[model samples]
Target: MDVVVARIGKAHGLRGEVTVEVRTDAPQERFVVGRSFTTDPAQAGPLRLRSVRDHNGITLLGFEEATDRTAAEALRGTLLVADVEEDEDDENAWYEKDLVGLRVLTVAGEEVGEVAGVDSRPAQDLLVVRLASGREALVPFVEALVPEVDVEGGRVVIDPPAGLLELDEG
Candidate 1:
């Protein structure tokens, strides 16, 4: 199946290298040299990975299809896709697409909301929950705040601190 590995960010320099908003957990494996990825818009790629580098903690990638700054800049915001076999046995992993739309509840089984999206940051991922009142909550995806993720059960049990859930509330 096709899975999003990363999204093209801004052009880094005069070269074709572009900063990427990595989506997959294993970027070193996914964005290796000579790896080709199918682009979401279709016209921007099949971009072949010509070079990969790290600049001040950001991942910069050069594609064979884009050889200059303008070419790389044109690919900004395009999603890079790769084919991968699903590992159903991996219980510890959860993709953004899999977590989105799942029911979110407190550990005591109180309805909280549904997962709207996932914000993948450098330190930890944040689960964007759509609350009943229509506001969104950024639940830190951690063992303490989010104890259980029952994908099969279509729910995630969160154990938030006193005011964590009310962060986005009025």
Candidate 2:
């Protein structure tokens, strides 16, 4: 199985570094120096990582093929794929790739919303849910709130606190 590790953004500097939107949870392990990855468009096979750095909170990557800013620019919007199996061992852990777009329902089987995005925070990750009534809610993706995650079933069970789901009503 293959998963997206990062999506190439605009070229950062003139050092063949391109800003990338990280998609994997283990960036430190996946984007390490000398690590090689395959591109989506098949521009080059095994894009070896030359350097990886953070600039103003954004991840910038330098690949072996892209030796200059112009070269990196050509790779804009390219997706870096990693050939690996999905790991879901931890009880409270869900990969970013799996959490996205999963449905969120109450314990009573009431439809609440669908996961729009996942925000990894220092304290706990949050699930940005797009509610049914066209409202966005930030539900803490904690074990207490979200006890069940059926990735294959494409749904999550959230036991929200009182007023947590009703806060969006104006």
Steric collisions counted per model: 0, 0
> lDDT of model 2 at residue 87?
62
Q: Please report, in order, the local distance difference test score of every candidate based on alpha carbons.
A: 0.90, 0.84
Q: For model 1, where is the 10-residue window of minimal lDDT?
A: 161-170
Give the per-residue lDDT digits (tens) of candidate 1, residues 1-170: 89998989999998899999988888977888998899999988899999999999999999998889999999999999999788889877888888889999998999999999998888888999998988999988998999999888999999988898788566
Reference-based TM-score of each model: 0.95, 0.72
**Model 1 segments beyond 4 Å from truth?**
none
With a 3 Å backbone cut-off (N, CA, C), the pairs that clash in candidate 2 are none
For residue 82, give model 2's deviation from the true position in Å: 0.6
Query: What's the lDDT of the predicted structure labeled candidate 2?
Result: 0.84
| Highest-scoring model, lDDT | 1
Per-residue lDDT over 79-137 for candidate 2, one digit per residue giving the tens place of the 0 to 100 score: 89988665657655566777889988999999998988887554567888899988988
